[model samples]
Target: MKNIARTLASLLALALTHAPSALAQASCSSDGTPQPVAIFERFISADCEACWSDAATPAPSATAGAAVLDWIVPGKAGDDAPLSAAATSDALARLQTLGRKPPVATDVHTAAIEATMPARLRVAHGMPFNDYLGTAIAFTPVQRAAQRTGAAPAAMDFYLLLVESVPAGTEGTKVARNMVRNMLHGTLDKRNKLSKSEQMKWMETRSMRIPEGAQAERLRMVGWVQDAQGRVIAAAQSTCR
Candidate 1:
């Protein structure tokens, strides 16, 4: 009986040793600490002759943590255009909600740059046309002390913008910039009046039908969290590989 027990134990140990190791599950959390940064959004139309000058102005490779997005309005009395009707409608709605005008350029070098900055937000990934573009974001109370005082806001607005980095337009005489191809917006729950250390996780997934002439490889995403007054509190962006 002792030998039989010993043999069974040896077999169990051998089986365990030969078994395939389980793969670690992938984490959906954002990579690093969320930092405050500005969110710069622009609306432009191809039909407007004045817009070409703004489009001609060189854009920086980076915005110093700011998420920059440009929305090109489609079908505005032009033979050559970039965005589709659906995309244009979506962009227009967002601009209207924020009470902003199109084709207006903002100086990135001034304090006005921070006017619409985001407090702290992280982006997981920004793969465009890869089945779906998705991001996982976590928001913590910026003012936990205010929460204790029962002064914290009940909720915050979040927006995920899908932008396409279009190359110089071969089909038209006009040039193209980093244009916002689509946008998604939602409200996150801050109803609990989160403690200073507590955080709320949110996920946004969007599957986009690539516009006929739009290049999928040049797509990216920008995401931002905004306060009740429409001021962006935090922003981040990811580029597609």
Candidate 2:
């Protein structure tokens, strides 16, 4: 069973490496600037013995341009007590909205491996809410010339994420990577359709409580845009000032 899983994972890795998309390319602009990336958020429980491997998975370098968020929750598949109830609830809501099953250790490996891929959109000018109340994300439309040669979707969905970089964790254990504290979802204006002629701006703000264990200085805001099919178009991250 382990061998089968390993083989499948390897195949998937190969596919992602060669996949052609704005997100899969090295540079999205003629000037050699990399496009913004999508956020890779993973949900897990500390008590789940199977989740340790994933929690230990290292994050992609900042140069990769992917912001990873890890949500630690408590439940049947989670720990006896979550590090932050607000964070857990936020993650649960996102997974439910996406109709995805609770993530296991393998999912973490998948996210880390996939982080190397390019992103379809770029996240720019991200900022945290005043008083640590929430975060604001700006969705800037991709330039027509920079976009992949394909029909643009009539509309897109946007999600705002509050992420904490590496936080204090148990000694001798794999360090927890990016941890998502909250998320806010929104849809772009259909009339605007994210046209390249003018950068269609979609902004979102989400209020959240930073977990007790999180380092306030390490907080970040991530913004991602997706199409109607739930395909990520672009993503970006910014640190709290």
Candidate 3:
């Protein structure tokens, strides 16, 4: 378990900041859009202010930092759950009062949020015990183990999805670039021929030394989905990232 956490942490860090050779050898598909990786990072409260964070005045990342946490955590599930109407009211008021910046970026849509989030936050691994927007927030079991052990998780408890960035109207051949399926055009119909090959390649190169000056794009999408129970599902990108 300790090794698992260590490995997972290393993977996370590598995904964020790997050496040049570690990236070039990756079997990037012919597709072009930049894929987005689903990293098991944390999100704090400050970013989700709902003003600059939402559409109209977007931040660089429509889906980064605290927004990720809000997406994974359940919102309103229980009738007995304490409603935060006051909090909501205050938040909304702040937004209106602030007079947001001049269209920094569009607000994050609900669909984007959903897609960015996992199908469901599994609770099997001692994770937060609620569905998206549910209550009883806490870390998943494997997540806790990793935290406790102060190591990367050997067995992560979620699916890490990699996404690709495509232009608004690019379809067909170009669409395959995205790692995850978008709502409008969910997943690629054709099976990915590259993923398996890449895996095999990864196995072979796990021990190989990276050559000099071979870094690639900023990112290649890959993500980890964790359920409330702490079950981890790993889903690498088929086409994009």
Candidate 4:
């Protein structure tokens, strides 16, 4: 059984390493920039107008080394909802993925990985064409100085988020927010049996639609990896040149 799993993982790794032109076109990346050590997610309901303007919104400090993402969830009011235009099904899906119910107003969750990262996780996007944007996320694990003895997990989950940077005072909000516009999810098999000369890496690429009213220039990509036990292992946010 272990050999079979390793065989499958090896095939997946080969596919990722030799990815086609789609990956070549993925121009924007977080490769050279410093990666964030934590993620701060905020979910707000469209029906609750006050939620957007809430004065108590949590804002991570610039020096905190965290990526903050805001998600506007669809509410019961449908089209009549105040922030309905900005709401997306992806938000609800994310909540479900986290095993949480929609908040009546707003909710915040934080996941912090390490003070000094041991893995490289990057997110990137290409130039937009036909209202679609090419995006990708990659992860490569590095041996820690003090290597642990346990075997690697069989798989890890990845999340690539496209968010619009909304400045403060734009919607009567006192704090700036990186509002999530779209998201891509993937699973990375870590069971590959690699030769000493081979590099073990996992990657996924996709085309994401740019939501209406979302400025392409303001869009940024954020990505994170979670182990099988749901512990975050790495996080990164893109910075366009």
Flag the better candidate by lDDT, 1 or 3. Answer: 1
Q: List per-candidate RMSD values in Å.
A: 13.1, 14.0, 19.0, 7.3
Cα deviation of 70, candidate 3, in Å: 18
Per-residue C-alpha lDDT of model 2 across residues 1-241, encoded as one tens digit per residue: 5445444433432332233242233211111334345456566654454554445554555556555677665456333433324336766677676677655432442222222223343332212223333334444544463265444345667776666666446422366567676566777674433344544444433344455555666666566666666666565665322
**For residue 201, what is the lDDT in candidate 2?**
42
**Model 1 poorest ten-residue lDDT run:** 20-29
RMSD of 4: 7.3
Off by over 4 Å in 2: 1-38, 49-63, 77-79, 82-87, 103-106, 109-131, 142-153, 167-173, 190-199, 206-208, 211-213
lDDT of 3: 0.25
Q: Which candidate would rank higher by lDDT, 2 or 4?
A: 4
- Model 4, span 1-241: residue lDDT tens: 5445444434432333345334444456686788786888999999998989987887765667788999999999988999999999999999998899988899988888853336777777766665666676777777552245234445788898988998998867878989999988878874332334434566776667788989988888898998877788888887776
Tens digit of per-residue lDDT, candidate 1, span 14-123: 23222312211211223353443555555556454455444465444455654456666544554564433323767658656766654433312211123342234544
Clashes of 1: 6
Better of 1 and 4 by TM-score: 4
Task: State the TM-score for model 1.
Answer: 0.59
Q: Write the per-residue lDDT of candidate 3 for residues 109-200, one digit (tens) a residue.
A: 22122232222121111111111101010112233433556633232232322222333233222211221211111121113112542221
Q: 189 in model 4: Cα distance from truth in Å?
A: 1.8
Whole-model Cα lDDT per candidate?
0.49, 0.49, 0.25, 0.76
